[model samples]
Target: MSGKMIDTRVTIDGTFGPFDCRLDPRLCYTKPWFPLAETRKVAARTQYLAYKHGNSSTETIHVIEGRTDGPDSVHLIEGVPGRNGTPAVAVRIRWKGARPTATLGEATADARREVTRKATARRKAARSGRTGAPRAVVVHIDWCGLGEDFDEAAFVVEPSADGLYPVGAPEWRWDFASWWCPACQDSQPWHEVTCPCGLSRPATPLGAAGWNAGCALHCLTPEATSVLVDLDGSARIVDVHAGDTRIDMDRHAEPFGQAEEILRTALAEAKPGELAATGWERAPGRLWGRRYQITFPASRP
Candidate 1:
């Protein structure tokens, strides 16, 4: 505030904008180059860094769209540009590492693939009349700790009554097979899947067993006892990430904790299931100790 105004330009995409990167002495003292306290102070300020910093340095115009997560996406831009005052810039921004999710394109693509795969499996199940919905793998959860390798240490996916029918075969494709849409939400084309919120449904094909491979996250279930969790749904689930991590095959992998959080949040916002859990107990381990049981929401005709 004491110094005379100095003109500086920050480039975004192809546009240049005003910026001030002059290291504030107060802020500079907290440089990582220094020790403990300094770094902590800097860290606190950095914890809320905006993408504008990157946009200023690298001259990249990154615009985020949508609500409920636009700002979060900008968190992807971290680190200073490798080259200063250069038309081009470089930064080892761990876009994925910055958050617990993939890019929009990545998430959508993965969802599309999952939906198709599930449709195929469902079609097969329907041929066999596998009326049996995905079973919930009951895991009594306990303490969760990140391994030294930072791998998932404790996790379990519990069946929930968020009642998000996975995207499935179009009604014309699956005969006599219909999914639940909230109480009376407008229905989509997919009969095997529907959204109670009337949001877009899962894109999984009808009768497909999309859960054959992934189980990345775990959701705590107080609904039913000794049940397996299904991965396909109309909402964001850790199961997709779980399967990506080979969680089901690797008993050592602990992803149940993340899955539980996902389910908890979803169920908390959703209507209570008609099938209430009856029993409760704990699992034997350093984690997954306290487990509960309740019934699942009924499926649509």
Candidate 2:
């Protein structure tokens, strides 16, 4: 049994595989009359139980009822069911390398460790007077459009002591307002000459700074006629049916005058017809007004 190799086989239910045999002569028994079918069933059941109990490998040896028998008397069998009256073969199974199941204490300790980690994190956040996650600040700018036309910009930032959140720079500057860069669509301070994407700041009408830094002028008349003048010097006249009339006309009067003059001159020279004959496009959906592009005359120094 120590050095000699014995041919061994294992059967679980009906599955079969090669088995390595390790027999001890001290546990040998005398060969009794065992029904071949019953012996096979017992051996298979023993191997299955060893596996279900977490044994990685198992070996079943056929032996008779005896205290000390030589390895010759003990035989390693493979699916052989002898006759009913034949010498009964008792199976001796040895389970190898079984993994111990986890104890209740170990499982409880793991759960406790997880709870402690979460408690520590919550305590840290409480001490700092902040949640672990940063808050999202959504700046919804409605350019007088409804539903799908509403533009929304969101910023995820760490909350500051003051309720106001800083835009581009760490220190907020009141002199310049934040404007969106046309090239990259990133918000930048108004005083920035060039965007990070290398796009130069577009020119705006005089006095069109602060909140109106990147605003398009929507000039409305009492007759429901409106002209939309963009910062790029493009103008479009559209007939507006309904709109908000709470515009800060007094604050934007100077910029409106400059934008209106540019549009008036461009229309007169380009179309050369009555204002009504210029073909006002109907724009009922334009809550603010329709935006049109026009070229500004070169400034003569």
After superposition on all CA atoms, what RMSD does each candidate show versus the true structure?
27.4, 36.9
Q: For residues 1-301, what per-residue lDDT tens digits would candidate 1 score against the true structure?
A: 2133221111122122111122223322121011222222222332233234542322112221122211122112223433532121111111222222222211233454554564565455457643322221111111112212112221222211431111111111211212223223233322324355533332322111111111222122212112233323422222222212322333334544433443443343332431132221222455432332211222222
Q: Quick one: best lDDT, which candidate?
A: 2
Question: Could you give candidate 2's per-residue lDDT for residues 1-301 as a string of tens digits?
Answer: 2333222212222233111222122211211112323343334544464445422233232212211111111112222223432121112211112211111111133444554564565455457654222222211111112123212211122223332222222111112234444224455544455668665544431221211222223322222213334323444322122233322343345545544554544343332233333333333355545444222111112
Q: Global CA lDDT of candidate 2, please?
A: 0.29
Off by over 4 Å in 2: 1-175, 204-301
Error in Å for residue 91 of model 1 = 47
- State, as a TM-score between 0 and 1, how close model 1 is to the true structure: 0.16
